[model samples]
Structures are given as C-alpha cells and as structure tokens.
Target: MRAQRVEDTPGGRLPAVADPLRPFESRSAGVATTERVLFGRLTTEDPVQAVVRRIRTAIGLGILTDGQKLPKEADLARQLGVTAFSLREALSALRDAGLIVTRVGKNGGSYVQRPPASDSIAEEQLTGLTATELRDLGDWRAVLVTYAAWLAAQRASAASSDRLASYAEELADADTAAAARRALGRFHVELAAAAQSMRLTRAELALHEEFDWLVQVLLRDETHRRAIVRTMLEVSATVRAGDAAAAWVAGEQLTAYLVTELTRSRLRLIAAGSAGPGPKRRRAGDIVAELRRISKQTVGILEDIADDVAAGVTMPPTSGELNGVVARSVLPRLGRVEDLVHGVGFMAEVGLLPEAEYWMEWWQRASDGTFDRDYSHQLDPSLDDFYEYGSQDYLTRPRATGRPNAMGPYIDHGGVDDYLVTVSLPVAREGTFLGVICIDIRVAGLERALSPWLARADGTCLVLNAESRVLLSNAVRYNVGDVLPQSSDLSLTDVGWFGWVVARAPEEP
Candidate 1:
C-alpha cells in the first residue's frame, strides 16, 4: 500500500522516530524496521539464497533478536516479493542449517534460534584481506568516529553528553561479549545522534553493521575489552566537556588503538598461515537499510518542523517579535517560518550540509491567498526570485493539495549552488492548509552517506528514483541522473516506493 501524501513517512530505523517512551535511547520502533530491512526486495543474488541471507543478516545483527517469530510463510513471501514455494525452500534451508525452528498447527510458526556466540574465527576471517583493505577500513572507521565525537561535543545537549559518559561506564561494566558489543556500538551511535545530523547517524549505523561482528573477535579477550571500555570513557569525557579538539584526538586514538589490535590479530592469523575467506562484502540489502535509517531521521526532523508550524509562532501569531523570534519586514508570520528555518538547519553545524544556511525554507499561503516565503538561511533571496514562487514544486504541490511533495536531486544553481533534494510536507491544523515544511538535503551528503555502503557491495549497484533515473551509483557506467538502460542483463529490485537498486543477476550456481 502507498503512504498517504501527508503520511508518506518511510518506515525508519532511527530511535528518533517519534516515540514518546525512551526516545533517542531505545532500539527502533520495532517490527516495521524488520519489515523494512529483512523483508526488503532481493538484489541480484540467487533468490532463495538471497532470502536466506536476509533472515540470517537480521538475526545475526540482532535486528530480528533472539526467539523472534518470523511472519507466516505467505506473509514473508509477499514482503520479500517471492512466491510461496520459493519462501518455503528458503525456510527449509534455514531449518536444515538449524537457524530456525518450525512447529505448525496451533500457536506455531518459525522462530529464530541464534547461536550463543558469534563467528570468532578471526584467523579465517582476516586471511583473505590485504594490508590495504585492513588499513582502509580502519581509516574509514577513524574518520567517521572522530568527526562524530567532535560534532557531538560541539552540538550535544547537556543531558545527552552526560548520557554518553554514563554509556561508556556501561561498556566498562559489560560482563559478556554480546553486552559489550552492544555497548561499544551504541556509544558511537549515541555520539552520532548527539551530533544531530541524520546523514551522520545513518553513516554510523552503516559502519557499525559492516564490522560489529568482526570486532567481537577482539572483544572475546578480557584485556582488549577493558582497554576499549577505558578509552571510550576517556573520549566520552571530552565530549561531555564540550571540547571538540580533545574529543577528536581521543576518539581517533580509541579507533586507532582498536585498529592496531585487529591488525595484530590478523598478523597472528597470517603468521600461522590459517587461510580462509572473510565474511562476505556487504550487499544491496544493507543499502536499502541505510536509506531507511536516513528516511526515519529525516522524518523525525520533518515532524519537528511541522509541529513547530502547527503549534503557531506565537499566541496569536500577530503579536510583535517575542522569544527572540525575528519578524520579517515583509511579514510577521514569516518569523514562524524563520524559526522553522533555524530548527531544521541546525543539523549542519558540523558540515553535513555545507550551505546549510539555506537548507530549510517555508512557503505559506496567507489569509488573502498570496504566498509568503521565508528561509532559515541567513541570506536573503533576490527580489525577483523571491517573487517568482510559482516554479517551486516544493511549495506549489503541497499548498494546492495540502499533502507531501519531494522535489529534486536537481541543481539549486541560482539558489544554494548545490545539488539538493527538497522533501516537504504540508503544515495543517484541522482542515486548514497553512504552509509547507521544506528541508533540502545535500545530494553530496546523501552520496557520502551511501557511498560507504554501496562500495561494500561485492558487485556494481545503483539506486534509482521512482522514475528509473539514477539517484546514486557505484558504477561509473551509470552516473546520477542517467536513465538506467532497459536490459535483460540488469536486475532492478524495488524496496517500496522510496527507492530501488539495479544490479546484474547472479549466474546459476
């Protein structure tokens, strides 16, 4: 089923998906994420094998968690875009592997049966990797973790900063590897959240997914584990102190130390000559999952923007500037829009959105029906451009229909001077349409957030817009905006209307 225009929010994985209870600190909103991630469309892999891998990835990553019952056979097949027969073959394969149990009749369905320990065969896992690959992954982790901590120090609230410190303590007290891994990964995830950029948060989750299991081999040792927790706490302290430079150094040091430990583990494996392939490169499923995460956080921010507008700028909204709300000489209600502009663009203070000053804009209809436009960005629009609001689909579509509209990957050439996608939803109270809340995400940021995951795919892949235009691609043959060729050689997999990926079909096994 399609999401209603006003209700077009994608099912997301971020904790900030508007939960009143345990918001920002809990796991996802629950099963919708499972549906989004595990039951998403299959890429170009053998369909049966693809289905098996999706379930295994979800269970292994704890997305499905221990003992969680999978949906019914028919339901699972429907979600996966496979037939019932193919679904059964996949489930039977899982049963044979002892990953799931099925007891039918009454009160019965397939239930996950995860092993108590993860695959700690680091020797085998690292044997196939070269020095360059190891160093590259480590460098990526360092850059991602360091910037996350630095930005968190600069932007995190007092409560959240203290929570990071407290979370570090939780890692110190973690008794088991499973508990420790969760704490370790959550520490970075929490740090990303504190930074308040959805793109950063999505990127952190992507980084964690690819290596969380690999890190457990090191965590199995008590000495290495304690060392990790100790350094994490120290970095958390810098973040709590709001010292960005200190946080940067501490976070990098922590990640670098872990990289050293992993390298040593790999070196020992190589010296022993215990050769085996490492885990599979991440797949297109992971890309879909990352997009869902970004979608969820974007929705969270969009909701905040909508709520701010719906709540009214002031008691009467006609009252003169109050609460530091700046009134525009052109219109006072734009002060509300101005407040919204600041509200949405705060996510870019640390460089997620470079020209973030113009990232948010509100276009509203007044009582007399003329449109009033305000930007959160400090720069004023040219008089002619400000007056020529008719061309903005971000405003016109939503204002006319009082619904949602997503526009662009188009260049904001005359405006922000960047490639941007503007996602907007109508601001309404009761039956009235007031305005549209427009949030412009940098296409470059989207590319950076997704590039890490797409690069992990073993083969070439490209994410396409609903119209089959490329939005992101790992293949040089297909750049963003290129129309993907219609060919029997290409396999296009749709993960709902939000996006799709095109890849080459696997050869028969």
Candidate 2:
C-alpha cells in the first residue's frame, strides 16, 4: 500500500483507499471507448484467452485486415484494459495460433494474419456447437446484414455501392481460403459501413468474434466461395439499384445460403458420411429465385412508367385529362406485365387511379416473403385499387415498411376462396407509394413439395409462412392455419426466403 495523504482528522486525512477498480489513467490519446457493450471490455473471462479471442476475431472478420499493424504493446493493453504482461502473453499465444506474427525489436509489433483452415483447427472450434447454435447464428447474422442492406439501399452513394461490387468481384476471384475469408468478412463490414451506422459496423465486428474464423473453414472450398460470391453480388446489385425492398429480400436469401453452407461445412467435419448436396435447401433456393424475379421486373416497369411521367406529359387536371394520363401512361404496362409476373388481385388507392384494379398479371403457381415477396409483389401495382387493398396486415405492410414482404397461407375466402400465400414487392416512384405487384401461390401446392421433408424429422415438423401460420405439417396435433405455438423446444430453420422449418424438440429418452 502507498502512503496516504490525509487532509483532516478522524482518518479524513488518509488518502482515500485507492480503488483497484478506479478508471485507468487517461492518456494523451484516450482509448477508443466502445467499452463493455459494443467493443469487448473483457470481464469474467480469462485475460489471455479473451485477448486471444478478441484479436483472432478481429483479424478473421477483417476489422483488422491482413497485414494491418496493431498498436504498440502498452497502448493495446491500455485499450483492452489488460495488464501489459497479459497483452504480451496473448500476443505470444496468437503467434502460436497462426493469427498473428510478432517481432521483438524497435519498430516491431504484432501484425494480424488469417490462419489456414485445417480440418483439425475447424473441428476443434466446431466440436462444441450444437445444431441449434448453428441455426441461431445464421438467424442473428441475417437480421443484421439484411437490415444493413436495406438501409444502404436508401443511404449509400454510387461510389460506395460500386465499391461493394468491386469487393464482390474480388471475392469471386479469390483462389485461397485466407483471401476468401477476408473478402467475405470484409463484405459484411463494408455493407454495414454503407448503411453508415457506426453502431451497426461495430455490432458486426462483435459477431465476428465467435463466427469469423469458423466461417473461414467453409470458405476453403471453391464451391462454397463461388456460392457466397454469387449471393453477395445479388445483394450488391439491389443496393446499387436503390431498391430498398429488393435489397432486403436479397439480403435474406444470401443469409439463408450462408446458413446452408455453415451446416454443410459442419457436417463435413463431424458426420463424415452425411455431407452431400442439401436438396431441401437447393429446392427452397430454386423456389425463392423463381419468386424474387419480380423485384427487378417491377422496378424496371416502375422506372419506365416514371419516364413516361417525366417526358413531356402535361399534368391533366379535372378535364378527364387525368383519365387520359392513366390511359397513355399506366394501363398498357399494368394490363399486361412481364411473362414472369402475375397477380391474385389488384388493389389501388385513388391518388394513383382512385381504387383502380389495373389488371396486368398474378397467378405465379410457384412461390414468394416465406418471402419479402414484398407482399409486394403485389396487387397488380395498385393500392391507391378496389376496396380490396385495405390498411391491414397483408396489403399495407409493404407500403409502410417500404420493404418487400410475404404474407399468408390463409384462405383468400372472399376472393380466390382457397388457401394462398401472397408475395408482394412494393412499387415506389419518386417516393410515392404507388402499390404492390404480387403473385398468389396456392398453399396446397407448397404442401405437396414440402410434406416429405417435414415428415422426415421424428418429432413435430411444420412448414410455416412468413407470419408463423402453419402451411404444412407432419402431425395432426397442429393443423394448417394454426399460428405456430411458442416453445423453447421449437427451433425454426429458414427455408429460403419464402418459409421456415419449425421442428419439434426431441423428447427425453
């Protein structure tokens, strides 16, 4: 204990007991403080392991990219709130772990590196994970990246989007696991960066701590790398195109693909024999691809219609001139949409055409938000349509969020009179909510293709639409149309962009 400087009697003169927990002395350059929350403020965990984990995670995630110089020993320890000795210990451990290289002299410090993904290393990291853990990781990552893409669509400048595109190309061209790993992590961080949210970028960095290195193990395979690059490009395209709704959809699909890859990579390590093509995920992907075609199609049509509005058309007032505008500008495209486009109904608001059911297309026998189909997708691009497009759960959701959506598996009793799922992608031009372009797929058709998969699992299995309504089920305990029951035992696996696989927990043996 150091000598106390007491100012008064009765022990008041004693130097206040130095609080061990007293905030560390601030330096000329203060610690960049994300602290216990966003940035890791290690507490309760072993100091050496925590430092190792944090650095490994940073390097893996590309937050500290390859060859990036780390701060000097004293500064790093101060920033991490660890002792100088502990920081040195962690650095030595990292060197042995192949995550960093160190030098011992003046102008020498730790430099970040990405370790090779050997089967041994990957299994060591993965062995402790349960299937549930894998699923949850994918879900949370999905939420972050998807929301980021949507905001990026609205906020990113052209140069930023082009940069994302360039990054995607580099990922596709990567010939090594380390290169791919860095690109993949960098893409997510840059996407968050494009969203322009420092908090989001930091959150993404936090996620990398647990997942980045593990994901690198999967990136080693060229097939997985190519697959991810394709999805990244898709995401970049939508963001570049400035279609917020479409960007969000593409983001979810990308995450679903990542989730599938992570599962397959896990299987390759553990089951040995079970690793092969994931037919269910592939089928779900095909279905999603079929449904999502409309976003680009709809956006194109909206742009064309906007051009018409821009080119030399006089704003007709009250002289049936507005009727003429609808005829010359709107009816043709709405009456006959692209081959891939279809609709179950058309609902419009008057500012658009005064509740006009501008008939174009709807019956896409296939699929969509089990889709952000933009519930979107839509009423023949009419909302401003018949009394049909009400401000309800399905019709109004896209308009409000300005994002694509999928809703239903409920009976369209008053209309189609059969159970259906509606995929809608919203249409907006110049920030005006025009309406949605939607397709109606019969839930029965989905049930047939999905039944066997749902049945393969031992316990209760269900196929759910965007909203937790059961679309298909293997057990009678819960029938179609019932909202899925909440239970900690239930684990929901996303089946592409359109639906989820709700699995019943295994019973105690």
Candidate 3:
C-alpha cells in the first residue's frame, strides 16, 4: 500500500496478472542422467512411494551416501530424463520427508541428510527382535517358512512345483556334503521367493543377509548344517506332495532340529573362551584348515578325471563337441557368438570370429566402428584349447602337457542344458601326463545362482576349456563353441564331500 505511484493510462487504470507456479530452487551438485523404472507394477496409489523406495534402495547399497551432494536441477533432470519441473516436484517431496537439505551460496550444495536414530530403534522394535529378545530367531522363521512352503505348494505353477522336485532329486544325487548343503540352502531361498507372501519373501532374503556373518560361526558345527538340510528336505517333500498341514509340522520339526544344534553351537563358543568367537580366537586357523581340505579333495577329483580322459574313455569336451554334433544328436542347435577384445589403439564394442584356425584370418571390429583383418595364427594362438596360466614375463604361457591345470570353474559337463556345470578331470595315460577332461555345464535351472552375479555392472565369470574356448559365462557376449581364454590353470578336485572352485575373470592389465 505504501509503494510508489504508478503512471495512469487514459482511463487511469493499472494492469492485472495471474500468478504462476514456479519450480523449487536448490543448490546441489549435478547427477548423471539415467532412467529408472520402479519394480512391480506402477499404480496410481503410491507412485511417489514407489520412487522413494527405489531411491532408498540405492542409498542402502551405498550408491548414494550420507552427506553426499545431490545433482543440480538441470543435470538431475537430464539424468532422470524427466523435466526439471518433475524433478523439482520429486525433490520437494523428499525434502518434506527430511531425506535432503538445501544450502545456499557459491560453495553450498544440497546434501543427503540423516534422520534421527530413533527411527532405527523403531524399526528394530517392529522387527520384534533385540539382544535380550531371543538368542535364536529360528523359532519365528520356522513358522513363517513352514507357512510359506504350504502356500507355495498350493499356488506355485506346475513348472515351479516340478522344479522343486527336481532340486530334491539333485540333493539326493549330491556327490559331496558341501553340494548338498548349498543345494539345500538354494532350495529354501527359491521356495520363499516363489511363495505368495511378500513378507515371507522379504524375511527369507533377510535371513540370507544375516547368514553372511553367521554362516562361518554356524558351519563350524556340522550338526547344524546337517539338521538344517535334513529339515529342509523333509519340508520340501511334504510340500511337494501337496500336504500343507504336514509341511507345517515338518517345518516345526526342522526348527527344533536347529534349536538343539544352535544350543551346541552356543556351548562350543562358550567353551572357546567367549560367548562368540572373534579376533582372538582360532577362526583363521580353522579357515586355513578347511581350505587345505578343499584343495586336497579337489585334487582327487582332478586325478579321477585325468585317469578317465587319459584312458581315452568317453569323456566330454569342456564345452562339448561343437564341430561334429549332428542336429539329430541334440535337442538344441548351436547359437551365434560375439567376441570382446582390446587391441593397440583400439577397444572392442563387439567382435565376431570366422571359422578359421589362423589368427591372421580373423577380423577385429573397433569401438569406433573400424574393422581390421589379421591372420597370423602364431599371434592368434589356438582360439580353442587355451589354458590361463598365471602371469609370467612377457607372454602368458599355455600348459605344455595335456594335464588340466588345477584351477577353474566347476562345470558339470556332458549333461543336458538343464543340468550343466563346468567340470575338469585331470588326464594321464600309462602314468604319462596327457590332458584333462574338460566339460562346460549348461546350468539349466540354476540361472538364479548365476544370473545375479553375472548381471552385475562390472566383472564377469566364465568357463572355458584347456584350448581357451568359451564354454559358458555369467556375462559378456558368449555362445557355445566360441573361442575363449585358452590359457587356464583349471583343474578339478574332490577336497570334501562337497567342494567347488569358482573362477573369477582376470582384471584388465
């Protein structure tokens, strides 16, 4: 009302206007652009919560951290591929939730803020767990899992139900105790994930997260591992037979089994001079002993394979015989494969190999869309039958003898795609060293075990033969019969009743 006077028009009137909704302003660093779709179905009821849930998950994974600055509006908008207006709306909502705080000034930026610690305590309380609450969470887990099993029995698709039965068969056929335990644990997790209850699924996943620390402590007690497996199998059978009530009863029984064994575990830890074994204890020594045992057993399996292969027995090729197999001989035919290579002044975007023995005949496609053909077989090395020997000098040498080197993936080769694993058997003839029997497993139903690790943003795992041909992989473009890392120190062993050596790809030099 006390403002300066305005100039009057011919009619002595002032202009009028409507107010506009301006976007929020915040001082934050820029973020990378990426589109993110929410998990499950996107519905109208909780779209904001859905977005919030994904962001929270990223935070949990350390993708976003406390006090880390957020992206600027323009960058954030670009990264999310959403309009700045939409991004601002989302940020405003987050600010109200206290997940972010804005700052002003040349050096100032928005940062992820921490909530009060009281929220953590409330979550713990809602979980109904505490140090004094119970020494074992198994009792509650037993009830939940048993209920889940019953529901799975009722609602699981026929294929899923059949898969459960098949896993049980595998459990029965497990050559080692370790395999049995792994298979057993896998069955439990899969069953829970397949269950109809989201709560059960989440609880099961939480159980695995908890197991990371607890497994070492618990596995020292063989009885505990055995009891869990036995109980799981029992419950699995009841569920498979469609007896929900019986499955529940079996689940309770499994919990009891765990309870007794956990008591023993507690006793052992107590006798070891503390309520829980830790830095001062002999845990490290025990781990070394276990590793030694595994090595010994793995060597034994290699020896057996070596004997069979050396004798010219019908041992399967590491990735199977691709060249000679007739279409009638197998259910599925060979598929296309792509190669990835790094060369001088160039890196690979994608590569394809022609059916040729000489490296000079092969072609290289560069990331920048350039292609070159080089055919010096000497430089190429055999695309197949290469072993990965550890780094030595200027050249990575291949194994001189036929004997399979002792470190590689555990592939169950020669089986149907639905039942595959990498397996290497050491080979020797008349006590003379030959080569190893190598097999590339087609891991049919166990995609879950492989997919999670293989689908990671970085790193990859693969199974190849002594010739360095690709047999199977968790990542990267691979097809059956593709040439792979030829130099491997891959072998087989039966260290324990259950033993496996997982192969990790070498880092770029």
Give the alpha carbon lDDT tens digit for every residue of 2-90 in model 3.
21111222221111111000011221111110002212223345445444544443333223446656656565555445556665676
* Model 2 agreement with the true structure over 1-115: per-residue lDDT tens digits: 4322222213222122421111222211001212222234566368888788777765564445466557667666776778898889999998887888876676466776765
Candidate lDDT (C-alpha), each: 0.59, 0.58, 0.39
- lDDT per residue, candidate 1, 1-509, as tens digits? 22122112333222223321121343332223333544566554578977887776666545555566677676678768887888899999999988899887775778788767654543455545543346567778888889988998898777666666666677667677765676676677667777776657656656664555567768778898878877888887888889999999999888877876675565455434312332334233477766665666555556665665556454323212211221221133334331112122211111112332223344434445444554523432454444333347766677776655566657666655556667766665565554455566665556545555554554566777656776765444455566766763667665542444545433234
User: What C-alpha lDDT, on a 0 to 100 scale, does residue 173 get in candidate 1?
Assistant: 77
Better of 1 and 2 by TM-score: 2
Residue 250, model 2: lDDT of 92
Q: TM-score for each prediction?
A: 0.42, 0.45, 0.29
Q: How far off is residue 373 in model 2, in Å?
A: 55
Judged by whole-model lDDT over C-alpha atoms, candidate 1 comes out at 0.59
Highest TM-score: which candidate? Answer: 2
TM-score (C-alpha) between model 3 and the true structure: 0.29
Residue-pair clashes, model 2: 40
